[model samples]
Target: MKRKLVIGDIHGGFKALIQVLDRAKVSVDDQLIFLGDYVDGWSQSSDIIQFLIELSEKQNCIFIKGNHDAWCEDWLSLGGTPSVWLSNGGQKTIESYDNYSDEELERHLEFFQRMKNYYVDDQNRLFIHAGYSSMHGPEKEVYSSNYRWDRTLWETAVSMDKKLSKNSELYPKRLLLFKEIFIGHTPTIELGSKEPLNKANIWNLDTGAAYTGALSIMDIDTKEFWQSDPLPALYPDENGRNVW
Candidate 1:
């Protein structure tokens, strides 16, 4: 059978990412989908991007863009921030690319810009960086910015009636076409909480590995979920911080 695996927010933790992929034993034949946020949080955004590029070249992988990535690109356009990024694990990302030239940085940025916002398959499984916006009416368009940055819309959509919620002003009525939607944003308290409040059909995969959370992945067909051991502590520099 063809196996499809969806990985949650990476947050630049290449080490944890490798570990999880190894554990999952990702094969060239398997379909691997990254739920975005590959950069930021862990300090290896550059390395992570390079690794992802290599994966795209070698395996069946699809990349989605996350809010953090959008923020990082925007931040770079405004002016690269060593202090801000480093403070929130950007240091690791910088450290990963210390040897790269200006050309390499530009290439990485370009790759990030090209990422798609969502991936929908015939199995009724939908993958997006963040949840869909449920605030607008049926005719309202879903924008990329909403996919990456908006949380209120996600909350509202998941909490509202499934049928009615799909009619959200922020999301297109076409989205109701799917049977199930899988997403990775708002980190859950634990790997897989049973409570509806802690868990939604949305399937949040970010276990908060960079902040007392675990790196996670889920198999679409079997609904099997896996998580890496949590970090000993929040990266010391990322205390009470949010960016990256």
Candidate 2:
């Protein structure tokens, strides 16, 4: 049976990414929807992007751009390295690219350029790297960066009163725009959960692979998930975006 798998933030943990995909028995028949942040943490940021480019050729993929990805793209194309980004893992991403040739970097840049801000499927499910503030949905968002940086959507869902029905006037308008929303960027570890979190039809898949938590992947339909070993264990010699 074909599965639609949604992946969380990678943060350059390519080994973990590979482990979970194998553990899940992912195949060409599966549709992989990546909730970005593919770079900026562990040692293989550049390699992860390269692998994704190759993987997309053999399987269906939808890559949603994340804030980290956006920053990386800017550095790659404009040659401006933001200190904030560097402090947050961009430095490691830069180090990871030291061995790549200019031509290869260009290819990787193109890959980043092609990533989507958000994707809405035929079933009305939304796959985005982060949340959007628009009550009308992501398409009508005035500040496009919110698509890759907003946390209010997740915050609203998780903090809503459980007794409130969707039909209630007090219900959040943004939640009504989609059947379901899948996002990455805010790690679930912050909420004290090491697994995928579902609140008010929003699924947060980021389990903090960039720090100490494990990387995760989930079947949107089955809600079944697979996770890699904690990233620190996978790369004990390195600290992956642990500071901020």
Candidate 3:
């Protein structure tokens, strides 16, 4: 079967990424949908980007732009350094590219620039780095940043009355926009579950590989998931995101 798998935020945990992919037995025939935040946190951000660029050449992959990725892109392309980004793991991402030549960094910048804000499949399944506030859908969003930075969509889904029928007038129209929505930005670790979470029609795949949690991947159709060992365990000397 050509499985469509949605992956969570990587946060530069390349080793963890490899572990989950291997465990999932992913093949070139499978479609890989990455939820982004490919950089910032661990020490292997640059390596991960390079690997993804290579992987995409032969495998079916969908890359969504993430907030962290946007920050890295600015730094790489314009030499801009936002302090907020540096405080939130951007420094490590910069250090990760120490060995890459200028041309290689440009390649990475191009990769980041080409990422999508959101993707909707033929089945109406939405794959985005974060949520969109537009009731109509991401296409109608007013603020482009919301596609990668908004949390309201997930909050609404999480707080909604589970018993409220979809046909109810109070039902969230945003949730009704898609058959399924896969997102990564908010880590599931903060929710006290180091596993993918499902609320309403939204599936949050960020298991917090940026923090002390694990990397996660899921079969979007089967809902079967595979996780890597705790990211901290994979990189013992590095305090990823230093969130602990």
Clashes of 3: 0
Estimate, for each residue in 88-182, the C-alpha lDDT of model 3 and write its tens digit: 98999999988899899889899999999999999999999989888988999999999899999999989989899999999999999899999
Residues 4-78, candidate 1: write the lDDT tens digits: 998888787777788778888778888998888887666666877888888888888888888777767765456
Q: Which residue runs of candidate 1 sit more than 4 Å off their true CA positions?
A: 75-88, 134-143, 157-175, 190-200, 233-244
How does each model score on lDDT?
0.67, 0.94, 0.94
- Clashing pairs for model 1 are 43-92, 43-93, 44-93, 136-168, 136-169, 136-170, 137-169, 207-214, 208-213, 209-213
Instruction: Give per-residue CA lDDT, model 2, range 1-244, as digits (tens).
Output: 9999999999999999999999999999999999999999999999899899999999999999999999999999999898999999999999999988999999999999999999999999999998999898899999999999999999999899999999899999999988999999999999888899999899999998999899999999989999999999999999888633
Instruction: Mark the regions of model 2 whose C-alpha exceeds 4 Å error after superposition.
Output: none
Arrange candidates by lDDT, descending. Answer: 2, 3, 1
Backbone clash count for every predicted candidate, in the order shown: 10, 0, 0
- What does the lDDT come to for candidate 2? 0.94
- Estimate the TM-score for candidate 1: 0.77
Candidate number that wins on TM-score, 1 or 2:
2
87, model 3: CA deviation in Å?
0.8
